[model samples]
Target chain A: MHIDLHPAGTAAALAVLGTEISETIGARVSALNHAVCAAHLVGVIETVPAFASLLVRYDPLLTDYDALCAQLRRLASGLNDEAAAQGRTVEIPVCYGGPYGEDLPFVASHAGLSEEEVIRLHSERPYRIYMLGFLPGFPYLGGLNERLFTPRLQAPRTRSPGGAVGSGGQQAGSCPRESPGGWQLIGRTPLRLFDPDRPLPYAAGDFIRFVPISEREFCALEAKKEGARP
Target chain B: MKILVPGPLTTVQDMGRRAHAAKGYPECGACDKYALALGNLLCGNEEGQAALEMTLSGATVAFEKPALFVLSGAQANATLDDRPVPMHEPVRACAGSTLQIGPFAEGLRGYLCVRGGIAVPPVLGNRSTDLKCHIGGLQGRALRSGDVLPIGPEPSGTTAESLRHAAGILREKPWLLRPRTAHAYLENQVIPLLRAVPGPQQDAFTEEGMRAFFSGLYGVTPDSNRMGIKLSGPSVQTIDGSDILSDGIVEGSVQISANGQPILMLADHQTTGGYAKIATVITPDLSAAAQLRPGQTAAFRAIDVREGVRLCRETAQQLRYIKELTIHA
Candidate 1:
């Protein structure tokens, strides 16, 4: 993983590149964010991590721009080798039809396939969490199967309620808040992807694979997993 | 406290509205964060304490009881019962005394922070008024006449001598909270140099169009508000047309509409946007952009992300040092 250092006002940022978009990359980035955040500096307040970059906010008074940049470069270089290592793959059960996936049929039709076929194709491949942004816990997963690619809505709706699973242009992610979205809404997840009250949600480099289940099984899981650990 | 006469564009504001960028909400808050910080500090309040933010014209406030207060930002001719008051200084006003903030002789916004902060309830973890969402701060709207706001607890260390001395100096002298000389910081109508990083979708624009964006001067239109600043400038041509996916737009994200004009997102902008973003203004220069009034012409300068972060850190450090000096001095 090669990291490009950028100057952002009074802070320095690390743009991690060349690492394959995978779950391991996401985890490594998250770990780096925590490590940097732990180092309390005059200007370094927080670190905002995105698909391939980590924007660290710092105080310019205590640390000069060049010094912070050097620190980030050093830290990023250390993480480069570790990010290349493999990470755990977590499975997420998704009910792909009915109310959970209001637009599943539409997506299936758009992709020239039946709803079951679309689900099968979607569940068949594993996805890498490139970054977590747009909202907390809203992972920007890359490496989607190109066959399931579809264009977003021309005019986005006023709001897409939380947990409303959506897909667009080979990208799939969940919404954390009620927001206007152009992505093709395929399904809803019972899981609360983002809970700011929680310590951490999904991190970068985490691998996620969808396991298709019946609507009945989804309900049972929802009820049984009420108090499940995040 | 009751608003006897609402000043022009007075709204309750705090530090900012955050985490709603994905929903396309601009992080609208105090336009002059430096002033707001001073006001809060003078009143011994927390950093994100709530206050009434007024623009150009000042509001007339009548107190229900004696309270400790400070006014910062724009230089508005303020008075208590027709007697001239001071700006950027803490003052103690008695119950039933009417405090009026007149029209601004210069600058745009002024912050009035009372001791203990504003008593209004917060929405979405913020008390900052979001004009677009019409939520938070005085019923999510601008201040109006006859609006009575409940005051919080009375402040300690508020005395007649401190109020008189602070107010006298502030009214007679220029603001001491000016930026350091290292930066080419401009005041009033003078626009600062805006540095930006190429947007994620910048490649969608033609190379010529990208060059035009950096070289061109854009005037902020009157249609601009907390949500976005509409700019009149050279039209930018995109190779793939105006189609793009709706995604998160942070504060300072410059979005081009179908008509080809750029709209610079501001504090109250929505979390996500579909318009093609060509550049994102660095965070340090955000305050400079916020102070811009209508008709101000601004130019975008491309800077590497490292430079942008360096500038931000430098500015923040200066502000922190000044804050410490002011408190101790």
Candidate 2:
């Protein structure tokens, strides 16, 4: 449980829990985040967990930087690496190809696989959520199969619709809102990834599984509210 | 209140959404937080009350009903109905009065606080408009012509007791509520000298690169926005390469891009960043940094993190002291 600590800003410090980007390192980051919150370390206003680091925001009025560093060091030492504490799984329905997935064929050719093969390789496995940051509810998903791995587009797209499932640099991401992106978008999901009404739909350490659906099914799901699908 | 002419990037904001960063939501709020806080304070409002935060440009708001409002941040020429009104000093506006604010003579962003506060229902526990996602504020967007905003009930208890002051007559203050942070952004103010602390990835920079960062005068690039103040000047590069596994980004982080430009992350910055950060302008100066517009030159001076923390504490104390001092007003 070696942690490298540095001052993030005047009010906060970052705890880099791991060096490499992997499930093991990510788990350690998640555990340390949970431990610090569970312990209620004084002055901790918020914690932002990324690939293998957790940035803790604190109030200087309540606690200073040195005190926070020592407190985080103490909390990180007692963290359980293999803790069962995890976020719930979310199933996303995708419509690959045509208007919804303009880059589906491009991704298929880039990976040297059939369109069906690309979809299977992507949807077959569950990916762990790293953290949302680039856009609201935009999930940075890990665990993409090497067979379907493809590089980002040479020229980025000006605008992508909400629920765009895109891949770049050995990682896949879902766009919760329409925004400019540079990734190779292979498909689109009907469900709104970032509805404010939904009570914290996703978090770090959560698991995401993709379910493929026909265009007709996708339209039906899009029209229906979450959890009310026929 | 009705928006006759909307300002650029005008939105309802409070202190912002800070508690949910671990879940990946960046805290989006007023770029100049201290200005907003002081504006709310002058209006006899709480620290976290929603206020209209306008950037670069100013908005034209027509009041259908009477309201008490205070303006702060950049200097803007404001008029009540057609008569000019003083800024920083509180004003009690009459119903059917139109308050037209400025083509800013100085500074970038300005804050407008009403007595009850902007009553827009908070999204994710904040009235702030997260422009990245387009949620919250008036229809999750900036103020537009013909949009009506409802102000909330004023909170009880105040120092100056601006809330209790009679509303029919314009209650104008003779003196100004000047905060230390606003000094750097005032018109005719010198090129800002921002005190900085080594960022999380300072080691990523080479010795010469670090020297370039400290010595060079970074000019604010036109690419700047509420998300960050992008600068292009002395090229500051890294030793090996400038790619960090995506990590959490601080609000005032000075991230150096592949092209060697410094991008100072502001209020609406993303929660995590992949670029290598060389330094962070400590708190108490972020407001000054937010007011920087394109073509403005800002230089960094390194300071001890402890001193930065101490100065931040002093700033907090100062705000409290102001609240008490206003008791007699």
Instruction: Pick the DockQ winner.
Output: 2
Per-residue lDDT for B1-329 in model 1, tens only?
A: 99999877889999886544322234678766767876776665654688998876889999898887888777779998888876666677899999989888766677788888888887767888877556778888998899988767755544445544544444454434433212333465444567777764676699988988887878889888777778898998898775554444566778888887888877676655556778878766666676667777787888776666566656566555544533444
DockQ, model 2, C-alpha based: 0.67
Every model's Cα RMSD, please?
Answer: 5.6, 3.6
Q: Report the C-alpha displacement of residue A117, candidate 2, in angstroms.
A: 3.4
In Å, candidate 2's interface RMSD is 1.3
For all candidates in order, the CA lDDT equals: 0.68, 0.81
